[model samples]
Target: MANTTDDTTLALDAVKGEHPTDIFSLDGEGDWSPHITESNLPTKIIWSPTMGFSTVDKDVLAICEEAISELEKAGVEVVVNDSIWEVNPVESWMVFWACARARAQQHLIGTEEYESIDPLLRLFIEMGVTMDGASYASAIDACHHYNYQLEEAFQESPLIITPATCGQPPKLEGDGFVNGEETASWVDFTMGINMTRNPAGVIPVGNLDNNLPVAIQIIGQQRADLDVLKAMKAFEEVINFRERAEDF
Candidate 1:
C-alpha cells in the first residue's frame, strides 16, 4: 500500500480507529511509531517450499529458493519444511466465506435484486444457502483445529515464508498459468493463512521471465504484526528488488 514499512505503519495508524477492548487495535502513542529496521531481522524463519499444491509455477518456486539463499546469507536460520499444515484449510475457509456471503445477501435471493448482480457472486451465495448447518459447524471446528496447528508451528519459528502466489499473475479475464496449463486455484496460498488470522506480509523477491513481479509471503505469529513487518523490512533490504513504472 505504501512505498516503505514506516509508511505502512503510518497508514494503518491513520485508519485503525480507537477500540479500547480490542487486542488487535493499535495503542495510540508508541504504536504508530515504526520499530522495524535493518537491525530488527528475525533470528529464525520457516520456509515452506510449497503449500503442497502441484499447480505452483516452477519459475515462482525458483525465485523463492533464491530468496531463501539470500536470507540464509544474511545470517538468518531458514528451515525448509514442506509440511506446515496437517490438513488443508482452504476447503474449510471456503465454507465460512460462502456462508458469510449468503447470510449478508440472503434477502436478495428469490428476488430480481439477486438476478441483477454478478453471476460468480450469485453462484457463491447459492452455494452458501444450500450448505447444511452441520457442514458449516464442521468447517468452524476445522478452522479452530488448524489454528492450533499454526500456533504450534509459530512456537518453533517466529515467521514462515512461502510464495505469495502459486504462479504468474492471472489476467483480468482468466486464471493463471502453471507449467503452461491454466489453473483456477493458483491463488489459494493466502486463504489458508487467512483462516488462521495470523499476521502476513508480502515482499517482492524477483521478476519472472515475462517481467512480471514475483513475491514471497512472510507469516508471523498471531498478534505479531510488528514482527512480520520487521521481517519484511529485513528481507526487503536483502533482496533489494526495485520497481520502475516503465517496467510494467
Candidate 2:
C-alpha cells in the first residue's frame, strides 16, 4: 500500500493512466516502510501532493493540527501514532475471519449483508459459534489487546487525524468491482482506530485534478469523543484548509 490504496486496486487504475506512478510492476513491499525520527515521531507524514486532499472532507486535517497545537499549549503531546499494524495479532485473526467469510459469500466490513449477529450463514454456524460462542474467544481477545493499546496511548490526546485513504481515491475497475476495489483500501487511513472503538469522523478536504475526494478522518481517543469533536469544530471555524492545500 504505497500511501494506502491496495496494490491491485492501484494497478487497475494505473491501466487508465490515472495513478501517479506505474502500478503494474509494484511489488507492494520492498521498501516504503513507515518510519519515525529522533523525536520518535514520524519524519514524514505520508502525503501525496499529486493525489491532493478531498474537496468534500478537507476540514479534518487542519482541525487536527490545530487541536494538536492547542493540546501542546496545555502541556500535552498530540501525535498521530504510527500503527504497529504489522505486529498486531488481531490482524492475523482478521485475515483468517475475512477469508472464512469470503468463502461463504460474506465480507467482514464492506458488504451490505454482513452476518455478525446470530450469523444465519457461514462456517461458524456449522460449528455453532457466530458472534461469540467459544472458538472465537482467541480472536476476540486479540482484538481486545489491540484496543487496549489505543485506550492507553491515545486516550489523552484531544484528537487524532489520518488521511481518509492513503494515496488517492480509487478508480473504476473492469468486469467486476472485486479486484479493483475493496473496503480495506477505502478505509486504509482510519479503520484501525475504528476497530479499537475510537470515535472518528471525516470532514471534506479538497480534491485532486481527477476530482476525487481526499478527505481526512479525525479520531477521538476513547471517551473524550465530545471534546475531540468540538475541538475540530473550533479549528474548522478558524482555518482555511482549501487555500493551504491548493497544491495538494
Candidate 3:
C-alpha cells in the first residue's frame, strides 16, 4: 500500500505552490463557511448522477426512486448537475493515472524507462476513445489536467457536492488488490478531488444490503475545506436522509 502520508504530501504539493507551502493549508483549513446560521443557508444545491438516475437496468430502479424521494422528504433538496460521465471516462482517468504511476515507478524500474507509458496510450488509441484531452502520455500532464479541473470546479463554489463513488464505497476488505479488482477499481470518484489537494470528508448516509455504506462527499474550494466540514456538521442536524431501517 502506498503510504497514505506520502500520497497526501505529493497530492498537496500539486495544489499549494512549491516551497513556503501554506502550513495551515498543507495541514488543512476545513470547509468553506458561506453562512453562519441556519436562517442564512442557501437552499440551492447540486447533485449529479449518483447511486441511480442514469441507467436502463429497469430493475432495482424503484429502490433508486424511493431513495431520491426520501432525501427530499428529509428536508434536503436534490440538485441535478452534470451526468456521471462528465467527470471523465473511466479508461481515460485510469490510463492517465496509470501513466502517473508508471512515471513515479520509472526511477525504481531502472534506467528511466517509459515501459509502462506505451501500452496505456496504445490501448486507449486502439479503443478509439478520444485521447484529445487525455494526458495518459505524460505523467505530469495527467496530474496537471486533474489539478486544473479540481481548481476550476471548486473556484465556483467554495463547495461542490458529488457522489462519493461513481457507485458506492467498495467492500474495503476483500481478497487484496492494491486498488481492488478490475471490476471495482474505477469506483474512485473521490480520488480526482484527492488529486486536486482539497480536504474532503465523508459521512455515512446509511448502509446498502451488501453492507457497504453510502457517503456524501463535501468538497471545498482552495484552502477552505474546513468550511465544508462545518457545513456538513450543520447539515446533519436538520436533515435525516437515511435507509428505511437506518433508525438514527
Q: Which lDDT values do the candidates have, in the order given? A: 0.80, 0.43, 0.46
| Candidate 1 clash pair list | none
Model 3, 1-248: lDDT tens digits are 11222233345445654336455425433223333344423344445444122222111223333444555565656665553234443444565555555445444443444354566544434333433333545544555666666565443345556545445333554321212332343345544554556667544454555565455566666666446555565444444444443543
Look at candidate 2 and tell me the lDDT of residue 110.
45
Candidate 2 accuracy as lDDT: 0.43
TM-score, one value per model: 0.89, 0.45, 0.50
Which sequence of candidate numbers ranks them by TM-score, best first?
Answer: 1, 3, 2
Question: For every candidate structure, what is the RMSD over all alpha carbons to the true structure, in angstroms?
Answer: 2.5, 17.8, 9.1
Displacement of residue 81 (Cα, Å) in model 2 is 3.5
Candidate 1 global CA lDDT score: 0.80
- Per-residue error for 77 in candidate 1, Å, reads 1.3
Write one digit per residue (lDDT tens) for candidate 2, span 1-248: 22222232344344432234765333333221122111222112222211222122233334334534543454444444554343424343554455465456543434454555445345443432244444456666666776676555444444555555544444464221112433333434443554566666554445555554445555666654444444444334333244333543
Predicted model with the maximum lDDT: 1
* Full-model lDDT, candidate 3: 0.46
